[model samples]
Target chain A: MKTFGGPVLFLDRDDINTDEIIPARYLTEITKEDLKPYILEDLKLPGFDPKGETTKAARVIVTRANFGCGSSREHAPWVFEVNGITAVIAESFARIFRQNMFNCGMTAIELKKDVIDALFSYQDCPDTCITLDLVGQTLTVQGGGREESFAFEIAPFDKALVLAGGWVDYADKKY
Target chain B: MGKTTAEKIFASHLVDEPFPGAKVLRLDVVMCHEITTPIAIADLVARGKDRVFDPTKIKAVIDHVTPSKDSKTATQAKILRDWARRQGVRDFFDVGANGVCHALFPEKGFIRPGYTIIMGDSHTCTHGAFGAFAAGVGTTDLEVGILKGVCAFREPKTIRINLNGTLPRGVYAKDVILYVIGQLGVNGATDRVLEFRGPVVDAMSMESRMTLTNMAIEAGGTSGICMPDQVTVDYLWPFIKDQFASKEAAVAEFRSWWSDDDASYDKVYDFDLSELEPLVTFGYKPDQVKTVTEMAGTPVDQVYLGSCTNGRLEDLRVAASMLKGRTLAPTVRGILSPATPKVFQDALKEGLIDVFMEAGFCVTNPTCGACLGMSTGVLAEGEVCAATTNRNFQGRMGKGGMVHLLSPASSIAAAIEGKIADPRKYLPE
Candidate 1:
């Protein structure tokens, strides 16, 4: 399984819908490359810009409840992946949005609401990092010489797919 | 233990006894539209599956960006058309050929109870109004359906929403759902299915039930289902043919699909609709709903009446009845779109189209247009619209614009007054 870690960029907001992730106005663009630049531009979401230094520096996004709500556009996850966000830790996710993240080979770690609240308390802490170990099914948050590990859940099928680099690869091998 | 409606349907489709996590299970129907099908077709070809397992079981429709709003979307639609034709898909609805997939498929008698339906659009839960198990999936999941006639699913717990008491005048299924979503919050039903039960649900018409189920995703529900009843049989029988020639015969065969009396549920919510009023949403999230009386006189620049939600015949009738022999306020621009071609035709035949036209409302063909800011009637800067479509998120309808979601009556009343107003005043006594 793939293992990765990166500095955390926390968005304490709840119900960050797909429309704000990648607004439908940009969906008409044919390619994900073309749509990438417009990701979350409309919302002006904190720390989410393809060129912003803070967004470029962070690899994980932490948000409270309903990280990917609203429309089931695959482009939402594609944009996040394009912007170098490999993992999103949230209190919960709308099912279709979570499935799209899995399809895009990104990790969506769901921690309890209070756990997310605890993570948000470190929002202004510089150089905070979160590490994800897929095989271990855990996310480790570290800042100021303190580290905490939070357990997460992923079905066996999803684990295999992520290990195989998403469903296209998984299906190619299985079939 | 007795199974909930979601469990009952999933259990029937399992090749073996079900467990908790993902498993490849049978699919009765797989549907997609222009926006999602291109990705699925590309992924299918990349996986060495040049054709589908069962083209007859798949339905492709071009409804989201219909009539080719631009060269970009037009190219995407062309790609879907070519791929669907090459695969010999039996139920492909090209641009202008039908309306939205969610409304068109079921209206044409494709959806039925005790079956599992999968689609690439989040609103696919709209079909669950027929007592079917339908859930939205991503494009990769759609690829699974095309290549293998099955998709993986992890069973979800069921939440029972027991709606009781009679609906008050001017209150509709839209109001009921809006109220439910407001109480539940957007994440209340996350990772779960919602089974709507009790007398209020049973009394709803088929179209009203569809409206109820269509917004299930707004509250993060995997799907929402109401048990099949006489209303379901009556609305679907004319467009369908089976051994059942009469309503009694159809009900006898389909009624067994309902959840058992002793069914277990993970959570239960009780709502009384007796005092419900016309509802409207003030902010971005659908859960930001309130009674129209509380929000009356809120100013608006435009009004849109359509979507998979609130674009059915019943919704149109409500709007038309209110706008008949009246003109929209000169400052307001309104667009009234039916959900399906059949609905548009029926509205036209019933003179509802003329009523809207006389009120200076732009009556357009069925599409998900403008609801997602895709095409037609897009909002301009700093403008606000009272719309009947689902979702009022910032810029959902256009850039720098606001969307306030309301029932058709509320939207129509807003258009007539150029501001949000109580719809009850316009309802006939």
Candidate 2:
């Protein structure tokens, strides 16, 4: 299934490595099903199953700068995929992480300060309604039904890949 | 115009054949690790491609996930193993067979003179030890390399580094690179090619040359290349003896790309070799280097003395000599990974490994392990490590692990005292 739909996961942390999301030990397996278990086990987020598991319903994860900071391991997004994360929203990303995320059919968007805060507050307040209009470059948030909007920048190269349904779809056409 | 190996190859491969100033060119060798290879393969499979464009041109290794630490790493290795077997890749060294790809690729003859090599790994530039034009590429771009045999190419500007005097007693090649990174800030060599030339370079073993070129990536350069001379020929002769057949032919082929005596160079950088000391990087940045003497008393909990750079026999001997009859400090974790099977065997024969193990150096099978964060020797939280590997990006070895990059000499010195220190204290007078 194309995991465009999501229940956004608010993982509040600083500098989460890809290994934590998808333990590097899973990278040897040919099937994603084998890697689905043990997702984020190393990170102490024990409940998230990498091989199976609402983590599946959550296609979007928001995080802080230097997010995905570590080895050039692609297991990060593979775990995200096996766990059903189709998009990653962050304030910043390690270059390698961004590439892996895109390669694995996940959309990683970088939102500005206010937009990030809007998402955080929405998760924090619960009453705050937030929706990311990635195509329009605007993030709208409503608290007590009051709405606000902010624009986000997506690099042209990234936009081409993410918007095109990720690497498999892109390589089919480009390569 | 001054010519860098990258520029020369770019011109050779370019459709328009750009001279000095040109746009980014196609890449040659596309490097990939377990971390990025899965996706690249998925993309390839989704497209129904049976095999890589040319398996001979690709170089794959399992350095990133050595010792198959946990289930996750083992899984990564499984996929890598299957893929390499399926693809008939010309060079696919099992993790323990070689320590680091950057060092092993050249040692195994995967990197040849006058050829262009590309890797999915950022440190692909390390293969330039044999004077090959190499570069790092993204996974997607690497996929492109696999689909089509060649990568686009444009020449890079040239920077000539001339080492005029004999190296100081304790200063090794790692110190030379650290010194270069210090002089030229982190981004000093952006898009430029660095060419090392001097009697010192000509005198260096091929392994040492790999050390010089391996760290060129840290300087923000496109790639680094050494002009092949007799030393290069002698080192590679044994491996390609059957391929090249005649030593004379091999030497002739090597001499072809050397810059002409009046060869134009974009910039000429001079270094007085005798002045360099054993340099140790105190922080994540390769440029965050200071002399070993200057960093005395700065404690380190871990000391890693191997990588693509300085994991060769000579380096092992130098380190073993430092550890003979000396026990590593209780607090320090001293680790060594020989660059290749051949290097490891040489070290074993020379009794270097036994000395190291007896002195408490944690020796592991050859693989990129720990250096790039896919191994058993990861650093614990808030722990500071002195390593000889290239690239000290934040949390490189492990989460929240602080790495201070150092030459093998400094790494041994630090291991002995559990702090970054001068190798002279442990060196033979």
Candidate 3:
């Protein structure tokens, strides 16, 4: 099984769309690697900077509801994957975007609105970290000398895709 | 147990039940466009599995950035062109004949009731207007559909939205759907299909119904569907005539895809349209909707009247009617693009193109250009646009630009006034 644990970046907003995740202008590039520097370049969040230190150091994203709405481009998730941000924790996600994350061997974890609010409490904690344990189906967040663990669920097929290192490998075995 | 329309289609096309509520289904059509398909093709080629499951069932288009904006976009088109030719995909639409994929595909009669379609583009839900189950997917699912003709999904639950009462004059399908999205909020329909029903939808033309469904993604819906009826049969009659004895026969065949009367729904909403007014989006999110009166007089730098949502002949006619005998405000730049070659030709034949040009509008070929800010009509920093496209997300038309989503009639009014204005004031009294 696969798991992820790393530094976290928090964006407190809803309906963060695909265009904001990876702007439409750069979609012409042929490779996933070409999409790295432009991830979240168009996002207009108050304190977030695409080129800042917080972005480069973060390995996960915690945001509010409907984290990836609008266009169904997979480049949004590919950008996250390339930047080493393999997990996005949100109240909910746009359906296609959630699936694309799993297809890339990345995780999109959904917690309740209240749980998401609690997670935001650690946003200002510079040392905050998130550890996603797929084997135990749990998410643990620790920072500011406080820690909490929450149970999470992933569809069996999505878990299988992640364990198999994404859809390409899973399909290679099945087909 | 009664079944929703989506559930019925899923049951018929099911190849396997992966888990309790997840289904593996056989797809009827796999649509591809240059921007997203090139990566899938490259991956398949690298794996030595560059083969399409069924060439006849695939429809390819080079649309997003046609006439290649840059060397990179040119390379993207070449990959799709070579792959389609190698696979013998006859339905491919290249630059001269190409339009926006969502608009062009349906114009060619590629979609039908009960069919299941998948495309890498989010507006693939627009095809669901024909009572089909169509969803936008990602590269992995597109690759699987191309290679194996199969895709997996969680079995769908549906939300039935009943559009009741007659629409007041000057109100259009775009307004009604915007109202619905405003009420539901962006995430209200997440992971669910929206079945649009009742007399209002029944009265809408196929083109109008398509406009309603095309924005399904704006509300995070899997698809937005209307039960196939006589309007659908009449719209498709020319292409389907040889397959059926009569239009009624075709209609009868399609009626089987309708939801059962007792069908269970996750939720139901009844919207009264008698009080409806033209609507527009004021913020980056599509759900941030307000009445045209509430948004009037907001200065705009551009007015774009096209995209799959509002680039059809009906949209052009409505916009032309408003622009007749009126020129755009000197401060506003107006651009119009018909959705397909047919729409463009028909608009020309009907003098709609002349009306727009005479009104100081620049007409371009059918590309999904400015809708996604790829080439034509791109907005500069801090500029604002009144557009008839689906989404109004931040920087959708260009970096640091703001977009206001509205109907074609409203868009033309904004062009003439150089600000957001209600189209009803210009309507024939």
Candidate 4:
């Protein structure tokens, strides 16, 4: 699931809770695919229409601190996965949200505050390309004759699961 | 070596090296609710694994989205019910009989000291109040536990929060915990286990301890535990004594789970409970707490006093006492829900229900109710409320409905005044 480069959908808000990720009204649907279209609907974020050109074309979601801060609903990460968002880079994540991301086999990386701010600055330039290298523990932003790399870390178990295409695949092999 | 309460419980479940790191640990109880169980069952069925590893250890409760708000949620509840029956899971609780899973699990004697527990809801940390090492896992992990009888953990470090001194009047578990969360930011204790020790914890009642542990997850802690002592046994005895050979045996078993005196901790914090006042959270995050006195008279449209947190019998009693003979403001609407059916029955028997009803409070049957913003007393857009529930995030109470989390006493005060008011005036000095 490693993508070489993609457009970044910058959600620059801090403390983006699960309630905002996918509201409780949308949680009754058991399937991830059905729940994807409603992601961030509660927050009323700009340009969040799931079927719209921008949200569909954006492969990466960059945000500030405490992304997915409330509730343990896996639907928050499932929305990103089912909607074709492969990577989510934030300043930090709530533990359960990060765990949910790994469980769904999506890459959730945490960069420093400065690195996240740098990424958020590119929101105006939608054409900017950010490449995530899971194996190399680095995120590269390349565009307009500028390329910068930021290093990050993931727990050994999460790394293995994400590399193995999520928890189900890992369980299929390990269990 | 001295082990923290969490390390002690985790080691008890370890089949190999005792240190904290990635390893499969045995689980004594695995819990699920309507919102999370359907996905877990679907995943298991997709893998062609219909049988649960241990039917007896699994608990399925239909608490969230109960009363069939919509056909979709109703179908999900039906799926959980049918799956639990087919799997021979004996602990399933259908709508009327079930309350919040966090309360019902421990109330039904599923959680024991020194045990490792996992549930699909984040507030599963509430079970850690019994000195059990419990944490909330996502649906996938719950599925893994159902199939494997074990769940993986990365062995959490311990933070010892030493709360001492007797609490001031009108300041209780909710206030102390909210104050702690305020001091320690929302992510302060992320991935760490919190060991609540010191004199204040020992003096607190079982219900109060549960409130403390229940919100520990709000601070991002993996688990919050208190040492099992006489207070623990006394509270759990009535419900769990029959399971053991004798009362002495049950007490002895739980007593053995205490942490060593010299136990080394990764970090420690000291707090004097007397310094706390009634706390109310103003912003979206729980950590944005302020003293009730500071935010009193802040206007509100609704007041909710129920959830896994602060929804027990004691919590109702506190609210009832404050609301007795006093009617809510014409502008304010109050909704009260007990944490469990037993709590509702006890409140009814004690006439606490009359006290609330007489004051124009809408008392409902036990369910998660409006805590998750699913059903029963949903707030309209742009409405503000003072609530006793845990989280105050956007859309937590309803779409565009703002919630300020407070203790039960403060919640009643807010209702009576039609705004956030200091609850200390209602309590004895």
Candidate with top TM-score is 3
DockQ of each: 0.61, 0.13, 0.78, 0.59
Chain B, candidate 4: TM?
Answer: 0.97
Candidate 4, residues B360-423, lDDT tens digits: the string is: 9998877887987888878889999888889998778888898999899999999889988988
- Among all windows of 10 consecutive residues in model 3 chain B, the one with the lowest summed lDDT is B15-24
As for DockQ, the candidate ahead, 2 or 4, is 4
lDDT tens per residue, model 1, A1-175 = 3445798777768898888888887777656677767767666564555456666677898988888898888888878777777788888888898887776677787888888887887777787898888988888888877778888887776676678788666654554
The global C-alpha lDDT for each of the candidates, from Candidate 1 onward, is: 0.84, 0.71, 0.92, 0.84
Clashes per candidate (backbone, < 3 Å): 0, 38, 0, 0
Q: What is the per-residue lDDT of model 3 for residues B45-133, given as tens digits with 9 covering 90 to 100?
A: 99999999899999999999988888999999999999999999999999899999989999999999999999998999999999999
Colliding residue pairs in candidate 3 = none
Off by over 4 Å in 2: A1-175, B15-32, B95-98, B152-155, B242-248, B260-267
Interface RMSD of 2: 6.0
| Alpha-carbon deviation at B13 in model 1, angstroms | 1.0
The pairs that clash in candidate 1 are none
How do the residues B135-157 of candidate 1 rate in per-residue lDDT, one tens digit apiece? 99878788777777777677878
Model 4 agreement with the true structure over A1-175: per-residue lDDT tens digits? 4443487778867878888888887888988899877867777566555456767777888898878877889988888777778788888988888888887777788889988888766777757778877778788886566678888887778887777777766765566
Off by over 4 Å in 1: A1-3, A44-51, A143-149, A171-175, B15-19
TM-score for model 1? 0.96
Please provide, for model 2 over A1-175, each residue's C-alpha lDDT reduced to its tens digit, 9 standing for 90 to 100. 1445345666666556655665544455656667677566556443444333345456667676556654445556766777766777887765556765765556677877566766777664434444666567666655555667777776555555666666545555643
Interface RMSD of each: 2.2, 6.0, 1.1, 2.4
What lDDT does candidate 4 reach at residue A39? 65
